[model samples]
Target: MQKLRHSSLAIAFSLLFSLAVQAAERPNIVVIMVDDLGFSDLGCFGGEINTPNIDSLASGGLRFTSFYNCARCCPTRAALLTGLYPHQVGLMRNGNSLTRNGVTIAEALGAAGYQTAMSGKWHLSRTQALPDHQKQLDWLNHQSQPDRTFSPVDSYPINRGFQRHFGPIWGVVNYFDPFSLVDGETPVDEVPDDFYMTDAITQKSVEYIREMSKSEAPFFLYVAHTAPHWPLHAKPEDIAKYKETYRDGWHKLRNDRYQRQVEMGLIDPNTYPKPELQGQGDDWGALDEATRKHMSQLMSVHAAMVDCVDQGVGQIIDTLKETGELENTLILVLADNGASPERYLQPGFDRPNETRAGKPIQYEGLFTPGSETTWGYIGSYWASAGNTPFRYWKAQSFEGGAHTPMIAHWPAGLKTKPGSTTDQPGHVIDVLPTFLELAAAEYPQTFKQNKITPVEGLSLAPILSGQQRAGHPALFFEHEGGKAMIADGWKLVQPKQNGQWELYHLAQDRTETNNLAATEPERLAQMKRQWQAWFNRVKP
Candidate 1:
């Protein structure tokens, strides 16, 4: 009897060891998404922002030049997490949950025995204000709301396959005392005096990385930052660095970024001559002295916010290095969308009117921008420069609206030429698919008894191996009536307010400067038909 028992124990030990070996062989993965960052805003991608950590990642990995987002925050996030078209995942126009029909990357990887955690924005949940205005204000100010329930419990990140979640549940937030700030399902009402939203997101991410490093199983960390977005909130020290830099005006900013892009071999200057801003003015010289100074201060605040995010990226890199997870860890850095062009006049909807100290927020009559007591925006002039070479800003289908710089870095596993950039067009939807490929996780036909939506994005693994995979046959886009279709190096775009369909041979024109709607009649009609077919199938 003793001999038989020993044999059975030996068999069990062998099986457990096999499982452990399999788990350790898998690489750790991290996805960092920043909000409202421009296509050329990062130092690695032609901007002057100090992003040494992210730039180092690019230096040791590869950059995707034609990466795209869904042209809005929530939509892009939904697509990125689920690997499905945003419309098919209950976020066609936002204010909805990431439907059960789609499985998140966390869910898939978690099922594959990988530990998962997310630290930052979780704007996939419903974000509508209550009918009671006082209650809404109370909740926004973090003064009240005895009830802990702000969003649907099922849709919260804690329940959405993240073993732990720490961040805001809503899209809009105040930097100091952010609305919808939560730790798992519990509300984080009070904060320290020096709490900055960007810094908090980074700290939590670093904390999670260290904690997860203790586990044997490889982990997945999603660090979604709400930096460089509206309200222009940033710290004073971060703002001071860029105050003098942006006073050169938007015209010079745009020209400088574009010139750097060409000189760095990021883009071919042959077909890509510096293009004019779409539906916005580029004449920064026209502003009066007061307006110019105010505008410069606003952009400085925006740059500071971006700089803070980069600092967080640096911290994350250091944490990874310290934890001995720098190698064999895949890190992807990309923006949620292009720079926002919206302006603010007052606190409306979720925007707060008073600080926690009962100070009235200032907007019309300029107060110091980036303070919790004031509201400010970079406006279209600065936004146009931010998007550089691309035509339109956020919420539009033009290149400026959807295009983003994507860096893929895996120190131990990288196979591509270091510091090289690829023109391979990729979308946020491809993110989940790439993670799945990396983790060797399977996408289920049904998750939690719900028939899951099929992934619309292709894997980018082939590109990482220094080879081209068969990319998308066509890329279709639509957000708030801004429409575009790209196929066979051809593009058809209709700006929301413009009300006209224009065609461009992207390989030739590159900037949509010369319209070919009248000349390429047959090709235009075919593309329109293709786009109409795609819309018909995917419309929400």
Candidate 2:
């Protein structure tokens, strides 16, 4: 009897050790995605912006120089979440809902024993089943609708595998008292007087982290921040930091960012020749004094918004340390798309003319921008500067629109030199696969009684581990009518739908300054065929 008891005790001890090993191997995931952020926006990415928290992560981990996005908000989010092309998930355009054809990362990770949670903007679905025009009409009619009654509950984050969620259901909202605020399935009708969306998102994210730290199951937290995008709303002190920072104008700012990027080794000065301004906008020096002041204030607000996001990052990092989860957590920070040049003079339903507190606002005429009652945009000039050496702006297939900065930090998992940059071309679609690889989760052939599309992205695990590996054979992107394809250092791009194809040898001219379309006819033709084939295969 003593011998038998000894054998049983040994077996029990072995099982406990195995379980502990598995738990340690599975690292927690925290993905932070910012909306409409540019390539050179972060301090680590060669921008002058004060982003010490984000920079610290880059300093201690890996930064990807050639990371790509879908060049638009909704499509990028869809690709990042589903690990499939946007069209494959039935997200060909804005307002399109995520179809059952694709499985979300949250669903896959949750099935693999992860506690999934999400906070901030979810632009994957329209609030109502009605046509988009009708939805817009409804929004105009009921500006102060507390609950988004029209939004399908099934489309909310709670039904989409997130165990907990806190954020606005719609794409855009007032920074103070946002519309369609939800906590799981319940709508939060009222907000505190001191509420700011960026700060609120951080609070909820920290709360979730603290709660999940007590559990044995590893967690996946997606913090999607809608900052530095539109309406130009920010706190007074934050905005004050950069009141006249843009006095030198966009031309000089662009040059300055480019120089910084080269000095930081983020870009090769020889390979990436400075690109000419392509978008139609006023030259900085040509603008009147009043217009310059207005533009400067708009940029100040934009910078302030980004500063708030960095502050939130600091809070989150502090929470992870307090919970003793910092060392084992894999943190990734990226942008949904590039900087936006969208401008508005007066507010429409989509762009509210009044503050959350019912204060009337104006975008035109003489009025200080960046206040709760004010609404404005950075316009094309500053947007080009925001993109730095890249050309064009959001909603296009140009490098300026698609290229974004991606940072990865995992002290326990990744084995690479800190502050190093990887030029291995990667896309937003790869995010889901990377998470699954790290968590040891399997991508299901079918999920929830529905057939799911196979993941189109390759796992970035090997690259993160400092291993030399071949990347995707070819990457394709299309939005509205703009399309582009990159394969074997050759890039084929078209500025508009049915537009003439332009070719560039990316290894030589990543900036797209010298077009080789006429010179490399055969290469352009072959790439064009590839792009069309991909479009046919994935189009919804």
* Local distance difference test scores for all models: 0.86, 0.85
lDDT of 2 by residue, 454-485 (tens): 89987777677776545677999999888999
Query: Per-prediction RMSD in angstroms?
Result: 8.1, 7.6
Q: In terms of TM-score, how similar is model 2 to the real structure?
A: 0.93
What would you estimate as the lDDT of candidate 1? 0.86
**Candidate 1 lDDT over residue span 324-386, tens digit each:** 999989999998888989876766567888888888878765556888888788878788789
Per-candidate clash tally: 0, 0
TM-score of each: 0.94, 0.93
